[model samples]
Target chain A: SAVISQKPSRDICQRGTSLTIQCQVDSQVTMMFWYRQQPGQSLTLIATANQGSEATYESGFVIDKFPISRPNLTFSTLTVSNMSPEDSSIYLCSVVLPKSGQGGLGGYTFGSGTRLTVV
Target chain B: GIQVEQSPPDLILQEGANSTLRCNFSDSVNNLQWFHQNPWGQLINLFYIPSGTKQNGRLSATTVATERYSLLYISSSQTTDSGVYFCAVLINAGNNRKLIWGLGTSLAVNP
Candidate 1:
């Protein structure tokens, strides 16, 4: 299994300010995913970031609001731009760990997550 | 877009009891996963079952890909097992694989 480290585990920001969350993996991975979870809600994927390409965002998300940077396989950054109170949520980074056998599919491992609060 | 639904939005059990959680998808999936989120908000991978069945200690999961549903079974429940369980699926759409998430089942095991 790969270990992931996320920074700014919890942050409080003004409505007009922005916050950037960083995810660092111990091993290089082919893809990294970002997800958000509002209070008492399910996890909603923000985007999937593949190395050497622009992130692919989900239907309700836009790159202008949630800009992502995948500089390399081991590191990625997700920035919530011009944040608002509605943007307050817990952001998480995830990756798939390949394993032998068991139908040749690996498990999904996630970071501790970054909890953002827009005041 | 594929729809994922989980049943028994909330569950309560006594220590040493058993429980089952279910996840249903609206379409075919290449990947089916079960995750547990603890009180501290850490997501832990419980099972990755696209098909067939798997067991890990007191936990086991069975997924019928053809039926588009999955079940997670936990035996001898403990207070430490109190948390939220989620089921997610990967729908391959035009060379891109997107994940659809379920609302999750919140479980509370009392001592």
Candidate 2:
């Protein structure tokens, strides 16, 4: 298990403004992912951040709206550009630990989440 | 893409009762995880049983990879267990680890 933390557990922002959320892990991880959860809905994968490479975004998401930066293996940042009322949701960061052997069991460690409320 | 399904979209259980949640996947996966989201919106990982059974206190999970299904059992439920339980699956294909998430089951434990 890894200890994960997110900054600004929650925040209220005005429309048209942008908010950058930061995620940090206790140890180095190979894979880091961003997710969004709307009220009364399931989790949606936003993108996967890799060190020294451009983030790989999901089909419905783009880099322009959600820019990601991963400068190192243990830290990453996600900025929500041009916030809107619809952008109000919980953003979570997750990391997959490396397995010990081939086809070994591994799980994801997620941050507490950042709750963004856009008015 | 792999499809994941969870049964009993919503459940209400009294304290001290036992319950089981099920997760079914459409394809074979190399990794399977169960998570518990508390009222505070914190996701606590419960199990990483991709092929076997694991137990932690009052919570236990079993995954049958060949059958593409997993079971999560909660014994002696408490009010603190009232929240959503999510099952995530990751299949090993190509060289990428892509995880598919399920809708989750919402459980409410009343005291």
Q: Calculate the i-RMS of every candidate, to one decimal place.
A: 1.7, 1.8
Candidate with best TM-score = 1
Q: A53-83 in candidate 1: lDDT tens per residue?
A: 9998988999999999999999999999999
Q: For candidate 1, state the interface root-mean-square deviation in angstroms to 1 decimal.
A: 1.7
**Kept native contacts, fraction for each prediction:** 0.89, 0.79
Given the true complex, what DockQ would model 1 score? 0.77
Which candidate should be chosen as best, given lDDT against the real structure?
1
Instruction: Give model 1's TM-score for chain A to 2 decimal places.
Output: 0.94
RMSD list, candidates in order = 1.6, 2.2
Model 1 clashes, total count: 0
> What's candidate 2's DockQ score?
0.68
Give the residue spans of candidate 1 off by over 4 A. A101-105
lDDT of 2: 0.90
